[model samples]
Target: MSTDVAIIGLGIHPFGRTPDRTGLQQCAIAVSDALKEANVAWNAVDFAFGGSTDAGNADTLVSELGLTGIPFMNVANGCATGGSALAAACNTIRSGAGKLGLVCGFDKHARGAFKVNPKEWGLGNWYGEEGFALTTQFFAMKIQRYMHDYGITEVALARVAEKAFRNGALNPNAWRKTPISIDEILTSQMVNDPLRKYMFCSPSEGAVALLVCPASDAEKYTKTPIFVASCLMRTRRFGTLEVFSPSKAIEDQKTVTQDASKVAYEEAGIGPGDIDVAQIQDTESGAEIMHMAENGLCEDGEQEHMLARGETDLNGRLPINTDGGCIANGEPIGASGLRQVHELCLQLRGTAGNRQVKASPKTGYAQVYGAPGVSGVTILNS
Candidate 1:
């Protein structure tokens, strides 16, 4: 039986490079802060789920939080790690496995572009050596095709990046805190055909944790507990094009994000128009532009117009990625999805400070798309 869930507490570590700290330390800070805010002891948490990459097993956090012998599961699903963890926790709770649970995501990787080992995914070693599996190339090719079909321009892409950096300047946890102009982004070095260096999100380190329980009991913890209207995940179908797909077949197949979002909106009894704010995957400016349409936030060819009119700015019709997004916060893989949720939690709670959307946002939406074709979406209300 599905159950109603409420987020009683949320915690996040500043997103950026930190050479001096270990993944465990960062996760500990986030978890401790979450527990303290929830007013729930670590031992009181009935179950736990976490994700990580290059940071070893997530349950290793037991060393820092003390061994409580709870059923802590580890998850790793490329960039959807955190979202998968949340799905597990929420399902476990809904199935009556537990009422109170903890979900954590953390990662720390070396400075540089992420390397794809095709052999790990069953491809030949030559695929890796020749850079045929590079994600940057996939983004460039996809965006080029999108622009060709939808009339999107390089300026539109630059505008998205410009907005991201400008929003990042208001986010204390953002990695790239300085804002840049559209001209600066256009003139930046090109990493691929159409994707410039400034247009892409950098890989970095960070951690985020959430405390969830039945909404009936949320008032015991906080008066402003955010309710989880829906949380869902989806994988690509046969005709879907993805970051590491073998083909870019343009067929009648719908994207995983589109499907997941449709289910989420239905379950929540709401539509995109009902959402007041959002935090979508912006691994690059192009991804953000495409996702705006894919997630049903707008029409296919409306991004160019919406972006040009500042319709997506902080004070615009629908403020999005108000906390800098991946472009400014950096992508920490396992930690990224939860970071989006954390930012929305702050916005709904009216505690987002400098980056808060005006006019009092009552509903929020978040979506995360990952490599090899996977997507996760969540809807929340205050």
Candidate 2:
């Protein structure tokens, strides 16, 4: 693990609809909670970085969070916003330019917020009009191809959703609190072929904040400080199949998440086998199944047996998405990736409440994939 930076505090705003409060209001609350957890006043934060997809500007948070005059930059990377923010803060501290910093993300999306505009990417207006631009359709096609090629079955997709909701029921901050059966998920409305309505995450609202400080001062913040092993972000390669890509190159290459994960493992001085728990990008059920392999947690086609044997459960060999992930927690865009890190922190500290892994996990991994082919991976150890 890295000896340069440590996560000293964490704060979260419950995911889902909150008609009464604005998105900025929620962000202020998360920051306040993080400062309290770190036992520091707002002015002590030497730098700040955060943002959202649809919520107001992040720099405006200074008004409510105190006019500390610290350099607060706004991150607007698609679904990788939170992860990108964390990387920036960590690098800032590692550079010895700051003693302490804050990374926060929050978003408030409408019921159907992830709509795509093909023309914006130069894919042509027909792309959207012909339904080739819907994200759900792309996920369905990718998983369907994998099933045909690797023997993954439709039932495996349902199993992923089943596990997500089961874990979500145990998470107090999760949006969907009730468990959903596999059969219910199997028969749910078919949003896209092979992908059901229950298998996808909704566009919702949430906020997450994390406090980073020099590892040397970790003991003063909390007894259970979680050190940052490595945090890396990468963009799509020419031949990779990324979101919103009209076509792939003639030669196939590893996905952005796959590349980022492998490099992160090397940087952290550990391999996939050392990871005891993970929170992967589950924008849809199939994304989790694919991400499991993409992140090197499992081999291709092994997911079929793993899910069938209940090896991915909270008490299983490797607990994935202990907080229900995007599938159950809903995608808050800016906050989603940070939500993964927040969950990893709690899991590593043994404070995840009812959703805690049965075995005390020493190392945790988190990955997030976003639009236009950006991926971020983080490794943490207790």
Query: Using lDDT as the measure, which candidate wins?
Result: 2
Alpha-carbon runs more than 4 Å astray in model 2: none
TM-scores of the models, in the given order? 0.98, 0.98
Model 1 Cα lDDT, one tens digit per residue, 161-183: 99999999999989999999999
The ten-residue window of minimal lDDT in model 1 covers: 243-252
Report the lDDT tens digits of candidate 2 across residue range 1-382: 5657899999999998989988899989999999999899999999989989899888899999899889999998889999999999999999998888899999999897377888766689888877788777778888888888889988999999999999999999999988999999999999888888999999999999999999998998899999889998999888987777778788989999999998999999999999999999999889999999999999999999999998989999999999999988999999999999999999999999999999999999999998878999999999
- lDDT per model vs. reference: 0.89, 0.91
RMSD of each: 1.3, 1.1
Per model, state how many residue pairs clash. 0, 0
* Candidate 1 accuracy as lDDT: 0.89
Against the hidden true structure, what lDDT does model 2 obtain? 0.91
lDDT of 1 at 33: 94
